[model samples]
Target: MASPGERAGEPSDRGRPVNDVQLSKFLSYICRHGAEKKGLTVQEGGYINVDDILELREARKNGYSVSDVQRVVANYPKQRFSLRSKPNDDGKLQICANQGHSLEVKGLDLVPILRPEEAPVVVHGTYRRAWEQIKKQGLSKMSRNHVHFAAGLPGEDGVISGMRSSCQILIYIDMKKALEGGLLFYRSANNVILCSGDENGFISTKYFEKVYDITKGVKLDY
Candidate 1:
């Protein structure tokens, strides 16, 4: 079992061609959940020193190199990782996860969605079994730092992240209501809308503008 601070690798865009998945998952594991645990100094915006990261025991054991890391970061369809940024004081490059971080990383430079007009169709995708509980208890961030919502439906132009193609249900959020209720919203670098929800760590049912069973093509009561 993964210990308190450790976590299994999380999902990303489906059916998107990727190379070096084994190495990619390792990199993702480090950036999103294991940087602090691995003793890498995570800086503002969750950026980690690549020199430090590539020097990890596991990375060294596997003979991973900077170009290998850069290849994985560049080929990931969702653009989950950012590499080749301006060097630090010592002239070493860095890397960071665009979102889906459990670390209390400040200044990820996420764009705030203050007005509903900013994301006209912010919606969370899930399954019916979860929705049964979600309707009553509201959408929770679960393992992540914030609840993820796609800016628009899958296959919709410009909608690249935030959901899996296999989602069986879709819950539309009233952004105006969410913001009015004091739930802050931010857009990740990959265009995923994120909210920590309310103080209780749930986005209440009151903010659900509509719910639909995508498999049935019918609206469901919430």
Candidate 2:
């Protein structure tokens, strides 16, 4: 499962073939964020019968099938979806997004992050255009369920966990201060950090220790 703060889907690279990528995006849209919008039934733990998803007009038009879904699950670099046998019904298999759910899914057995050592500082990557507002108002979950963070700092081993190529700014969070400030954090299966916002759905800028404008190659003190 994705960390509680993570959202499903990644920016699509233009040069890649569109069919499978589109199918993966469509799956993430419905499975992680918009099942009800499509009138698809989501069961407890956010599982949806594979056949039910395949019944969608778009799915049929695209020639999507169980094998296609399996391929997506197996090949998606993030491992965003997981497939399992229905509880007490070994004959049936169900699929669900590992995390990043906007829908009110019940009984999702998300694991908790109990050890502080496991996550030191959580990083958030965004475009520079949003930096001013974020500097003043802080990071908000927006329409999604949680404020997502990368498990580690950027440029570490040439891998920035939660970062997208579109991002030009990186926000480094003070996790210790955040926890001391009474914020709850969870780590998703893929090591993305997840946190539900306070009553107002925002994590104030006070928790951010540093902001780097990667495009400009400098850190903004403010």
Candidate 3:
């Protein structure tokens, strides 16, 4: 499905093309959660070689080429991924998810949030039922590597990713209490606050400064 002027394994000559949402999902799965299962070696920081991805049967069947990958990444609205050429310069690129990894990404590029001032307003978005469960057990990482947090409320200026738009409740973490309690937090490339919950994989409610029913625009009694 290459365009007349577009060629496989080559960069496009003009402006970036519209992103392929389906391809985005495919790459997200492979780099963020399915590399090993898909028979690709995910390197540190969740990177998989571009050439290897193109070799996947599904990719080939969809006619995805190197240019398609680059164009899609270039046009992606969110900072969901990073694509880089190796120092070896083997005419191939490596791709990785910026955050939201369902798998371990050891040494992933993240900024340490050492003080409350660094991320003054940290929140997690969820619905009512889940919030009720979170109220009892606190926040759990669930299956992911870390609990994801938003630097600012959804749709706020400079806050582009993390948390879904349909969330009915917003749980705000008291960064001061969380940090004083020996919890760790990092800022992902997409500006998400990644919290390494306690040894039990949960952030106790004692660290929550505020919980609000955002749908109703009212603060809930914690």
RMSD of each: 7.2, 6.2, 5.1
What TM-score would you give candidate 3 relative to the actual structure?
0.88
The prediction achieving the highest lDDT against the true structure is: 3
lDDT of 1 by residue, 124-190 (tens): 9999779889988999997778999999998888887789889999999988888898999999998
Reference-based lDDT, residue 164, model 3: 84
Q: What's the TM-score of every candidate structure? A: 0.87, 0.84, 0.88
- Cα lDDT of model 2 by residue, 83-165, tens digit: 87767865566788866888888866566665567677678999978888888888998877788887765556423346665
Ranking by TM-score: 3, 1, 2
TM-score of 2: 0.84
Candidate 3 C-alpha lDDT tens digits along 1-222: 443223323433324333377778888888888888888988877778998998999887677778778877776656688988865777579999988788777779899999999999899988898877888899999888889988887789878777888889888899999999999999998888898799988999999998889779899875
Candidate topping TM-score? 3
Runs in model 2 deviating more than 4 A are: 1-18, 153-161
State in Å the error of residue 4, model 2: 24
Candidate 2 residue pairs in clash (backbone atoms < 3 Å):
1-189, 2-188, 3-188, 4-194, 5-194
Number of clashing residue pairs in every model?
Answer: 0, 5, 0
